[model samples]
Target: MTVILEATERRILQNPLENPEVLIRIVDDNQATCKSLQFFLEALGYEVRIWNDPELFLKEYKENEEDGCLLLDIRMPRISGLELHDILIKENFRLPIIFLTGHGDVEMAVDSVKKGAFNFLLKPSNEKKLTETIEAAVKLSIENHLKENNKTIYREVFDSLTPREKEVVRLVAQGKLNKVIAADLNITEKTVQQHRSVACHKLSVRNVAELVEFLKVLEG
Candidate 1:
């Protein structure tokens, strides 16, 4: 199945200041199910945490200390999926949640969606469908991680430089733009131009914007 991310989902992923380590939590009452998802997701390069019981999962994740999305079974012992949803909010977990149910119901589905569940899936799901959904979630997690890391000193240095020498960022971000920035900074353009020539050589950026974006990732 194709994965669909609404504009809102895209924006969440695009934001640069989101949490890194958006962890994928899978909660079900079956060990086999948990293992199946965990293995598939780990193979797909996601960070996954799994639990075979709702009570235990809630116990472990008592606080909203986790990142990423949740894959929760709609039916479980101790607490039902809806109850768990309430618990998640009451505990202040802003993490997105996706529900899975062996017996899907319209009212239940509507309520869950209205309450911010990512998507609801039936049991015996297609691997492709699951994978696609996971891909969307993973993309959001990584993007947020990148954004958070980009807020560091490295990113500050990266953002502080002229838009041009950031092109020489390999050298300039490292303090190399002695001549190029001189012209840009109106000081001794030749100084960093020497540095720019070297910056261009080292950072391999044809220009500064690329250097800035690269620096953001490198800071990650």
Candidate 2:
């Protein structure tokens, strides 16, 4: 078990998108099912958590938890997977979700995907399919987290700029030359150049291409 776990960890580390820190939350009423999945997923190097009660999971879930995906069983008691998914959406939850369903629930699973669930798997899910789907979902979760983090950083940095610096950055992103910006702003070319240089330095962008990219985060 130790050797297999170590090997899986190494394999996950080698993939750029896969991180051992990614948490996998499983919600199912069946104790046997939860135990089986916890063992399988942990062997693949994920941190696994299981809940036999959907309401308990909801009560304990933290909205701003670390990067991860939810492995939810669709036909749980008290609160169905689809109902929980709707609640999470209304709560602005961030983690990607993959639903586990039996063969008869295929249509419902498809509808969930249409409504923005990451994906779904039939019960007795094939090992290869489960691994691939989880990998993709976790990759998406990490990417989204990075994008939001970058947006926050960019917003703070942009807010720190002087008004003139912000203006110069906007014009530069619009592909205006320094002399044109100077003329438009009734300033000297040297002053425009200085503003551009200071702005670029503050934003840590090396060139116009990077500057444009930085501005895009702010715009978005």
Candidate 3:
């Protein structure tokens, strides 16, 4: 229900490009618990935002530009944490999620993890465990963000290639030699080689191995 910014004034003044922001969003119905966590996590230097209403959080939460993670309570009034997690998954939300579960909710929490929630924290969690889990989730969020960004860049570059260039790249990815590709396309081997060179240059790939790896990532 509250967004706490307890970071020092000096920390706030620093260039975000140099010190990227790390956000921790908490969605729990209990106001007291939310405030307690907000104070604790903010002291640890995270930008914390809490919500008492699951529906409100769902309505307001968008894909974050900064590296971050979500701390969600397992049991709530309207939308349970598991249900929210499902919706996020269906929407392709990639922020790492750490579920806050009560003793009776442990089994459900485990199931949520299997379905792609990052991890779960038991209620009344110890400070050390909570901090460690949040740190790991933030790290993962950063890595995932970087990978998605790279994929976007790769897709843009790939789309820029001509149809013939794309066909040549696909053949090369299938381990075809220039002569074999030429025969398949009914083109000269020299023309096939030219397409290969152009594709590699456009993709910024130095060799076949690199090109293959790039294609693998793009396909994945």
Candidate 4:
């Protein structure tokens, strides 16, 4: 199917704010379809990268580094798109994934969506809908990337705490009072207060609720 974009339509989809620091990664065994999607997306000013083989795509893909949503064909040679999505999930990849599927593969696409795929585009997708979906997916990919980066920084800060501070943070996050923590760790309340104060400063949290939220984000 030929995809035509009117000048106004192009303008609507070509907002720079919507253009994130992300490329469109396309993995499809069908050369013609790949070329069509690439052309359509690139015409709308998106940076696109294509791979004809799922294995090659997997080898090249890195979590949070490549930083883009995936456009994958649901049925492929060795590793199916669903299988690839599973592998990415197992490896803790948080980028949005958009699957390309035929009518027969709708069930698999639905299953992938349930497993956190961004969305699936039917073969011979509508030009308007495809571009809109890709834009939304790119925005989501950027948000996910920011979240993963934030998590990394938080984990680093959490790791920088001394063992004693770590214990204090753990107990505090578990809703233990400083006196209870001191008793549990066989320390005076004054020592526990000192440790807790330092931990709070290091973690940059003013209160126990904030510290617990940080811990939750770090763990996630």
Candidate 5:
């Protein structure tokens, strides 16, 4: 089966208000497919970085923490695409991921999304569709980086808390009441109350629920 991408179709997908950065990391075992897509993306004016192996890709990431989204192949030698995604997440690289796979790998592609892929496209996909998805992913990567930075800034509000208050916060997030927290920590109820008051004051949260909501953002 072939995906039709017409010559008249737009090569570019979206206009960037600010010049967007994209790093096309193609980790396909096949040289032809990798080169072909790299050519397509470069023709659209993106900075293309082709990789025939995952180790080289990981080495690049380890060296440079830069602005970009990954155009990843679903199946590759040495380190699989899904494995690379896991490694990136573990290393705190939140850039959006777009998986490319063949028709026979539909289930694997669907699983990739469940595991945090931005989107998956069929191999030999329509050129227009490919560019459109890549553009959306770059936009999403920018948004994700912004939100991650916001969370880092917000987390600083809680940094002045004592080690005990930190423990209290973790328990509060677990829905433990003050009395339960006291019993678990072997601390007096009054001390627990004092810690809660201080945490709320420093965090600028009117109540426990707001603090929980704030923590939820950090998890994302």
Candidate 6:
């Protein structure tokens, strides 16, 4: 079946950042289904990875390090899609997952969603729906990946701050006056100002407000 996408979807695909080496991982034991889905997604300009064994998919998938969404089948040999989803969560795998279900597996699919799967597709899924779902999943994967990357970068920057600077900045963000910060840290007000200035420069923020906002992103 031919995949049909709206103009917005096409525009999103055109943006280079949206395409980031992100993968669409299919974990279905059915070889034919995996091959067909792989071909369809690749034709639409996505990198596809297929695993016929749920165990292998789990073993190979690297949490936080890999950028992708999972396309998991709800029913499989040895490990069902639901069971695999549980395993991933237990292992702290945060990749968005989309389950593929047959007609009789609706209940299980719904359960997967409740347990944090991105969404699900039915077997013989509509070409348009499948394309759209995969696109949405990939976009989410990229977003999550960038967010985690920022968290790492921000954490490193925060770590680079000296203990005095860290204390000063924390107080500054809490609306403490420089004099109060100096008294709290047992330093001169001028020294507090110096530490705050250095921290703002290291964090690339202009003032306490901006630094607070930057740290909020890290909190997420």
Each model's TM-score, in the order given? 0.55, 0.88, 0.82, 0.73, 0.58, 0.84
Q: How do the residues 136-216 of candidate 1 rate in per-residue lDDT, one tens digit apiece? A: 665655555435544453455445556655544554565444565465556666655665665454544566666555664
Top-lDDT candidate index: 2
Ranking by lDDT: 2, 3, 4, 6, 5, 1
Residue ranges of candidate 6 with Cα displaced over 4 Å: 1-20, 63-65, 104-106
Q: Write the per-residue lDDT of candidate 5 for residues 16-130, one digit (tens) a residue.
A: 3244455656677778988888788888877777778887888876554455678787678778878888898788767778888773377877777898888888777988898
Model 4 worst lDDT window (10 residues)? 1-10
Residue-wise lDDT of candidate 2 within 107-186, one digit each (tens)?
A: 78778889889988888999999999998888777767666766787888889899999999899989999999999999
Better of 2 and 5 by TM-score: 2
- Candidate 2, which ten residues in sequence have the lowest lDDT sum? 1-10
Question: With candidate 2 superimposed using the best TM-score fit, by how many Å does residue 33's alpha carbon deviate from the native?
Answer: 0.4
How far in Å is the alpha carbon of 86 misplaced in model 3?
3.9
* lDDT score of residue 162 within candidate 5: 87
Per-residue lDDT of candidate 6, residues 133-192 (tens digit) = 877777777666666766787788899999888888888888899999888878899998
Error of 6 at 56 (Å): 2.6
Model 4 whole-model lDDT (C-alpha atoms): 0.79
Give all candidates' CA lDDT scores: 0.67, 0.82, 0.80, 0.79, 0.73, 0.78
Best by TM-score: 2
Candidate 5 wrong stretches, greater than 4 Å: 1-17, 150-220
Better of 5 and 6 by lDDT: 6
lDDT of 3: 0.80
Residue 218 displacement in candidate 4 (angstroms): 1.5
True-structure lDDT of candidate 6: 0.78
Give the worst 10-residue stretch by lDDT in candidate 5.
Answer: 1-10
Say what the RMSD of model 5 is. 10.4
